[model samples]
Target: MFIAIVPAYNEEKRIVTVIEKLEGHVDRIVVIDDSSFDNTVSLARNAGAIVLEHTVNRGQGAALETGHAYARSVGAEFVLHFDGDDQMDPHDIAPALAYMKEKKAQALIGSRRLDEHSTVPWFKRHILLPIGKMINHFFVRERLSDVHNGFRILHKSVLDSIVIEQDKMAHATEIPAKIIAKKIAFVEFPVTFTYHEYGQGTLSGFTIIKDLLFSKFISK
Candidate 1:
């Protein structure tokens, strides 16, 4: 059984499209609403996703843990960690999962390097991307173009092996570190990140900068 775990916080506008896109690919779509004040839960349920609502806003890491636990409890064989902002392309799901199966890898990260059409901002490409790569190389000892990408596939075995300790944005860094520490086979597949004007930078740039620093420095 393949499961897709999408962590959403007040993302009512685009969750429907995200759910609809995963329709045939994923056996079950679990959307964890992280204490959103909006109608995210109702909209997700109406759009055919199994919804899990958190009473308080615990951040993306908490939401993902909730979904991952639920997926494991329900006997999911393979799991896809995704974002609810409609950024990830659903078409990458099958191929990415197939790569993991073929390689017998415990985890497969859908990297954005293969996307030649990405229009990422200059700062992200110039500053953040290199910083992320260096961190992955130095700490995780894995050479990958993208490190903090939220789209990835994991086998149940991998999920079982790693304990997610981070409650916020650090899970982006923590997951890979845990995978490597356990000597799990890790592979990276290129994926495209779609930027919707409505969704891009929905949070403040300063807030994103702060979280990026926290994930990179403080979380480590």
Candidate 2:
């Protein structure tokens, strides 16, 4: 069945809205709480989402891996990574699922860059994102319009093959790199989004680059 895994931090206020909007869109909604200090787990369960938790704050990447693992354990064939911060539209769900089947792809990535209707801040549109695209392209050698959008769909096999080692924001960069290294069939779908300011300033391009360097080069 189709399952959506939402990784959330201290998003008690927004998690309920995200879960409710995803209702009837996917078969199951699983919220992976990254040791959130707030009542995110309780609210997610109250909102009818299957809630999972990390005893420690393992970051977004770890939360996602936990959710994916749980989705697979529950026999989920199609898995979608959704944000719990209420930044994305739940309407993109159906099209992304359909695109996965149409392209016979193992993974489907939603790109805000492809949608004319999407909008973002000037810094993201002209600065951070372009640098991200260039860095991602350097590794994959593919022209991907967007690299950091977390809206993604993956077949169980894709998840099985790709191992997420980064425990934080760098996992966003690591996932696609592993997919490219393994030659997995993935397609980028057009998806619209609204960029919010919450937690947006935590990491910068330099931080991402430093993490990427450590994970891709030094760690190895």
Candidate 3:
């Protein structure tokens, strides 16, 4: 089975659209509603997604972990992690899966930098992302073009191997760290993100850095 796991929080406005875009791309769509205060859960269910609820607002990482567990329990052969916000292009899903098969990689991560035409914001492309890349390299020791992108696909073996411990944005770095630690064959694929009014701002970058640094400090 193929499953797409979406971690959502108060994304009622775009949740249905995200699910709609995902339809026919994967066998099952699982939406982990991280204690959304809006109509996200009901909207997602109405859109034909298998909705999983969190009583409290766990971070995106924790929500993804919940989705991961459910995916594994259902014997999913491939699992895709997609954000609830309508940023990532669902059209990239097929090519990414094909590339994974072609490269014989157990996992594939989407990279905006790999696509020359990707319209990344100036500050993000020139400043924030570069700094984030450096920090992630320090932690994972792998030079991934895009470290914090939420779009990725993992084979069953990878799903069984890595565990997401950082229950926040730091889980971005943690995922690659564990993937590298386990020596999983992974590759990066070109993908586009359509920025909108609700996209993450500059401050979130610092938050991610703080979380990563704190998590690293405690893990030692």
**Clash number by candidate, in order:** 0, 0, 0
Rank candidates by TM-score, best first: 3, 2, 1
Model 3 alpha-carbon drift over 4 Å, by segment: 217-220
| Lowest summed lDDT window (length 10), candidate 2 | 197-206
**lDDT (10s digit) by residue, model 3, range 1-220:** 9899999999999999999999999999999999999999999999999999999998999999999899889999999999999998989999999999999999998898887756788877888788888888988898998868889999999989888888988888889889999999999999988887635566887787788777766753
List of clashing residue pairs for candidate 2: none
Winner of 1 and 2 under lDDT? 2
RMSD of each: 3.4, 1.7, 1.5
lDDT of 2 by residue, 1-220 (tens): 8899999999998999999999999999999999999999999999999999899998888888898788778878999899998988999989888888988999988898886767787777777778778887876567787877899999999878876777888788788877878899999998878766633442665677777777756543
lDDT tens readout by residue for model 1, 20-83: 9999999999999999999899999999999999999998888888988997799899889989
Please provide TM-scores, in order, for all candidate models, with all chains considered together.
0.88, 0.94, 0.95
The lDDT values for all models are: 0.81, 0.85, 0.90
lDDT (0-100) at residue 26 of candidate 1? 92
Q: What is the lDDT of residue 52 in candidate 1?
A: 94
TM-score of 3: 0.95
The 10 consecutive residues of candidate 3 with the worst lDDT sum are: 196-205
